[model samples]
Every structure is written in structure tokens, then in C-alpha cells.
Target: MAQAATITIGSKVRVLRVRDRIPADLVEALKADPTGTVTGFRTVDGQGIGLEVDLGAGKGAWFFDDEVTLA
Candidate 1:
């Protein structure tokens, strides 16, 4: 398995891939510009890491560390 990328707040990143069940409004925006800046970090019970990816156009989403790369 590929090692997970390390992400930090304000880190620049590009989407490597995405899950299928994303919100409808974000689909085109995500595809148009996969690059985004990490705005915050999230965790489930302080466990797995989830990232706050901020793309322009009021678009942002939480992505797994494996779904993005440091840019």
C-alpha cells in the first residue's frame, strides 16, 4: 500500500483521486481544479485524519490524506 501523505493546515495540495459519493455541487468544481489548500484537520474520535481541502469558488471538502498529495 502507498504511504499516506502528510498534510498540514495551509498546506498546498492536489487531489490524486476522490470517492464516488461526493456532493453534486462539488463534483465539477473538484474536477475543474483539483488543487486546494488545507484549511483544517479533522479526526473521528481523534483517530483517522481527515483534511479540510479548500478549493476556490466557495468550494471545500474533507478528504482522506491518501486522496491528496503535497503540492
Candidate 2:
């Protein structure tokens, strides 16, 4: 399988859009301002591809490669 585009740690990323795969509760908050910093990688289905972004002010969210972009 081809690898998805992933943001590097400490890089800034913007939430382009949230997918149905994301939990409903997190969708709105994640898209509120549409910006965050890549803090780390998260595991999903045994793959360390999920991107962890910190939105600052103690707020943060994790999104897959397709949900965010370099900002």
C-alpha cells in the first residue's frame, strides 16, 4: 500500500476537514479554528500513522493524513 502524507513532528498543520472515521464529539472542536501543531504519531490498526496535533490552549486532536495539511 502507498503511504499517506504525514506531517513531521513540530510542524504546523491545518484541519482541512474531518472525516466520518473521526468521532462525532471531536469533529466540531477539531474544525473550530482549523489549525494545530504536529506533536506526535498515534497508532491506528497497528500502524503508527495517525497524526497527533496540539491546538494549543490545552486543546488538541488527532487526525489521519487525509484530514490535515501543511500550514
Candidate 3:
């Protein structure tokens, strides 16, 4: 089994699934969230990517990766 890869925003990534593949609505939902405070970007296992987001209303190291593929 493949290990879960860590992803972050602004980590240079690409979209893997299409509108029909996953659902156009789903994609839109993810886009709705704003990239606030999320400054840096990073990846894990090269499977997916993510971004280091601001810890707003939360704690500990956190990130947000809207894209599904690597950039």
C-alpha cells in the first residue's frame, strides 16, 4: 500500500481529476476557501502537495493543499 503523502499550498502542484472525474461542485467547494495566512508550500512522498497555512483558530503545524496532484 502507498503511504499517505503530505501536501501544502503554493507547493507547485497540478490538478489530477477533472470536473466529471470527481465532481465539478466538489472542486468549487475547495476553491471557496481562501488561502489566508498560508504562506509556504511543501510535499510528502511526492504523491500530493500542500501549503503551510496560518494557525487561525487552531494550533500545531498545519497546511492546506487544494490541488490533488504535484505542481
Q: How many backbone clashes does candidate 3 have?
A: 10
lDDT of 3 by residue, 4-62 (tens): 14443334333433322434544454455322344465664586544444423442133
TM-score of each: 0.81, 0.71, 0.31
Report lDDT (CA) for all predictions.
Answer: 0.80, 0.74, 0.40
TM-score, candidate 1, is 0.81
Please, what are the lDDT tens digits per residue for candidate 1 over residues 1-71? 13244566888999888865888788899778899999987784466677888998899998877788888
Ranked candidates, highest lDDT first: 1, 2, 3
By TM-score, the better pick of 2 and 3 is 2
- Shift of residue 23 alpha carbon in model 1, Å: 1.5
Q: State residue 19's C-alpha deviation in candidate 2, in Å.
A: 1.8
Model 3 / residue 32 / CA error / Å? 20
Native-to-model Cα distance after best TM-score fit, residue 28 in candidate 3, in Å: 27
Which of the two candidates, 2 or 3, achieves a greater lDDT against the reference? 2
Candidate 1 local Cα displacement, residue 14, angstroms: 0.6
Model 2 lDDT tens row, 1-71: 13334457988888887665766545666657778889888877785477889887677778778777889
